[model samples]
Target: MNSSKPERRKTREVRIGSTAIGAENPVAVQSMTKTLTTDIEATIAQISRLENCGCNIVRVAVPTKKDTEAFAKIAAQVNVPLVADIHFSAQRAIEAIEAGASKIRINPGNMRSWQELDEVIACAKVNKISMRLGINEASIRNLKEDTPSRERTGLMFEEMSEYVREFEKRGFCEIVLSAKSVDVNRTIEINRKFSEGFDYPIHIGLTHSGLPEDGIVPSAAAVGSLLSEGIGDTVRISLAGKPENEIITAQDILASFGLYEKKTPRIVVCPTCGRCMIDVLSLAREIKQAVQEIQKPLKIAVMGCIVNGPGEAADADLAVCAGSGKGYIYRGGKKLAVVPEAELLAEFSKQINLLVAE
Candidate 1:
């Protein structure tokens, strides 16, 4: 009910096991497992970690027969819906469907033939599971060598359109479509086209986004841009590091647009400057750790100086304006108390509990 939330693009709802995509549902945050699918126990453990971190759907690579076998065992043990990542093989896709995949991602550009696609589609229809027509720009074979960036997107869109028509022709409507590019602008442009071109739920993200430190900005720009325009139904941040980081980063992007149901406190801290009096950075760090167990949306601002402190406090549910040896606490933009620096953490914890109780 927040006015800050974007008006979501209305699309046909598709159920992936227990999770629903599109319609009025909150934008789902998803991540792929990094562990080898052949390691069934490790895959299950990773899925558990992802579920604990609020991943709505967990994808695992089923590129090999052994991987699909492991996927079946892993799917049986996890509560989260499993998506089989299939590439180059319709047999693998069919195996994954029989292996209990709630959804499967296959790039139509790479499929050998229409018959193969039809076979995969028929299996998914019979299994009553969903499929993702995932189109990665890099995989489009017809793209001429040294094609311009703009032309590349056109080719991507063309490939996706052909596949979509095939899927629809086969009466396969339980589909989620994705057109991904590593380039930020192209990623946004392609997904926008998908939104306008089809009523299927769109999964948005950049593929091959590098390590976390370097990937976050571009990932945010590509994903956050689509989300702001009400374009994406589900998102993956696609960092090169841990998949948990991917989930966390995706949640942060969704939260920015008010599309995520945040179960953790929202911590806002000022970047301390020369005008700051107390150790705002230290205090903010302490507050972050102290509030780890909080499971509700609480805006706690830790400001270093008087200049921006009061202004930020007006918006935050709870705020601390630090002075020389003491800190001023604000609840609902009204001054609650002034506590010595030593008791700031203790006093702030007390106030947080009271607010939570209320």
Candidate 2:
């Protein structure tokens, strides 16, 4: 596999609180709070959990005046940059920023009046906060107004261009941009155009990605491909589940592209076939469970045959190859033990602990 890192697109740097995106910065991971904004304690607790799990930034929906008030309290209690998800109401957008949002996401197409957008932009400028010109295809009001499904990306790009012009006219360059769609192809297409058309950092995600089981594959496909192309500055997986799960998914996607800063161990196991002579699946599962508390970014492999086992073992820090009733354990490509099948896992665990200790 050609795992060469993608050449990142050049973009102006934008900071949301202390976290920076674009202009060669590592791609940041973001997730939203699923709790109601008015429930200040619950929102705070959820944000804390997200921060603990390595989310770079957290967004909260602030659609009501009371939510903005609660948002202020939530912001006061947390250290992660908070983004206010605003829609339709420029007043809410302004209030959220005033209440201490590091950034606000709004769509100009959703706002009827230029004057209201001006107000939101002006408030953002005064607060010295960043703004994201988020364009969602499903939320575009004129979806059926002579626009074919095939042409939606064009419409989205045009809408984004118009908003960019308006922001630039107001001398507001502290901006991040995003265009999302539930359809994987559209999501990929619109973001590609965003990258080509603007130097602003792009937030990439598949919007309304269904429940975890349904969302993981499409989200991985859309988000992973964009990052691999160097088109995104930040990522949010947007699964309809725990927000922390979204953060984990985002981190995994970034790690696959070698764009994530934090490190965690990686485990590789061969897909056993007719040539296999041991229960590779059960042993691999045991190793995975055993390594939950290990933090070193060690590469571990479990192979069931000679076809690719030795080659894979050469690349791993610790590996085991099984044949019939026994297994061969290797450390740094050198044989360490030949143990019976029943003792393979125990020996593997000891080696893992020793490697981690080192």
Candidate 3:
């Protein structure tokens, strides 16, 4: 049989806290905290929430000395691995590692000079911590005020390769690499080019991907393309909204590609048409909320018309096909019973519970 799955890239395994990244491990989900890191209570609460929502790694910005001091307290309260995002200053990177950050992320090309780079690497080696060499088009120094688009991407790739080589030569191979650009195609191309040359795990995302609704589509397109090609070992769905929304969007993107295991009922609802009888939109919303706490992997279909509903949803584990003001429950394409509109939510929950019990 012919298969469409992308061939896996061979990479060395690196550990972030207790989570093992690269090698044969599943691609991990990552998110950054928007809260001020110095606010111990707020940062811890946000990190706890992200962990509950299936975030595998979390990054906190260490922009100042205060933030570096806060890492010790924040590290004590969170369960997932913590990475300190440092820019320009190698001293802050050393401070954060000493304070117990599991990893530190810096652009090796843009960070200080060779002496400072060695300082950062020495601290990381002594602490036994991992690092991410993040190089982006926006951070590349003095390219041109108006360089051509094509030339800009090429420069970003060249700069990233230099950093990758530097990290490798220093015996600091526990690194993750990212080459981000606002342009989706450029982001994909740079990572693909780097994958061909190195075995370091690539952290993939399109930077500054605007608001939730608009940002999600482009971010998903970029991430999905790379993941489909087996080019990403970790991913972050960057958005301009609440960080929790990023977690939800990331899960949805993975689910769409069938990469994430369906732990909850996968609801398949059709767009209502003129021939629709029941309030399909409202019913689908109600059913989703009603089964929000269910953790079983079941497929549920909600269709507008009865004629094609059951047939179309035959593959679903359970389904609801609407008539005038009523609906029929289907179990594997066979009708089990008629259900009133008011009781649809309850009925679906009851069936899910039965499945869970078994």
Candidate 4:
């Protein structure tokens, strides 16, 4: 475990279906399906893709009874655990629980009243499903329109604590908590407060994180800060791109920190400068797309100049350093073979397969 504050609150282990969150379990990566839940086939297909991309949990919107009905079939067909994102409807939550959702994410303030909240809690308990109390900045209760900036996050924290206390009061401890805000700094602050106040595993992410280049960096920074402090147990990298993109982003972030093992080759490519080399960018793209289906951990480097390439990438398990129209294949910092530029990718692939097979 990463070094954390000595007084870190101990969170109860909550099982979302067969997967356990909190209590020393491996941090999970989750993504929501953009496909409408009623379109079971599309939802299942999207989820299947996410599963292949290493998404541990998948969430689908269950806005109505019909969507709840679809959850049964989708849950049955999908390989990963499923979560139902429910809003404003305890009845739908009940239906989704009956239909086989592993977890339900609800905004406590939106539920009709105390009775409705009780009904939702009861259904979750009876079904033995976990609940995620998802509280966002905009959804926080009892906040004045002109509240001071310094107290805004405190108000959000208070609301989250109230819901968590309510869930505990109902004798239901199977809970995951998320407090997301559009502002990355505020998101970090709220989670930091929660970490001090409670032991429940936190699901941290910046809501509405923009596009790939711009969005991924900040989102990773925010989540990374919390994770480095041993604060987050699961995370979602919300991006405007495809859901698979989010999964890949999450995997990369974890891998960069040495928190996740690469299930596929870890390609280390140098950005081509004025070194004058074969099409390094195009070659890297081709290799990445070509070997996307492989699932073993290996490191491959594509460098522009041989002088610094092999020496700089000496730590790579296998590397191809390009020079002029030729490339040298090196393993463990020793040159093994020289191949024409055109055949470099194929030779690299062959070597990777052999290494992975062994």
Identify the leading candidate in terms of TM-score.
2
* TM-scores of the models, in the order given: 0.96, 0.96, 0.93, 0.89
Per-residue lDDT of model 2, residues 22-99, tens digit only: 997888889999999999999999999999999999999999999999999999999999999998999999889999
lDDT measured at residue 255 in model 3 versus the true structure, 0 to 100: 69
Clashing pairs in 2: none
- The Cα error of candidate 1 at residue 218, in Å, is 0.6
RMSD each, Å: 1.6, 1.6, 2.5, 3.2
Report the lDDT tens digits of candidate 3 across residue range 140-256.
865886998777778887887787787779988889888888889989888888788788888999999998888998999999898888888888999986898888888777766
Q: What is the C-alpha lDDT of each candidate?
A: 0.90, 0.89, 0.85, 0.84
**Which 10 consecutive positions of candidate 4 have the poorest summed lDDT?**
1-10
Q: Write the per-residue lDDT of candidate 1 for residues 1-358, one digit (tens) a residue.
A: 1338888999999999999999988788889998889999888998999999999999889998998888888888899999999889999999999999999999877788999998999999999999988988878867777899888888888888988888888899999999888899999888888888889999999989999999999999999899889999989999987899999899888888878767888889998889998888888989999889988888889999889999888888899998888888999899999999899899999999899888
Error of 4 at 119 (Å): 1.5
Q: Which prediction has more favorable TM-score, 1 or 2? A: 2
Error of 2 at 252 (Å): 1.5
List residue ranges in candidate 3 displaced over 4 A.
1-7, 340-346
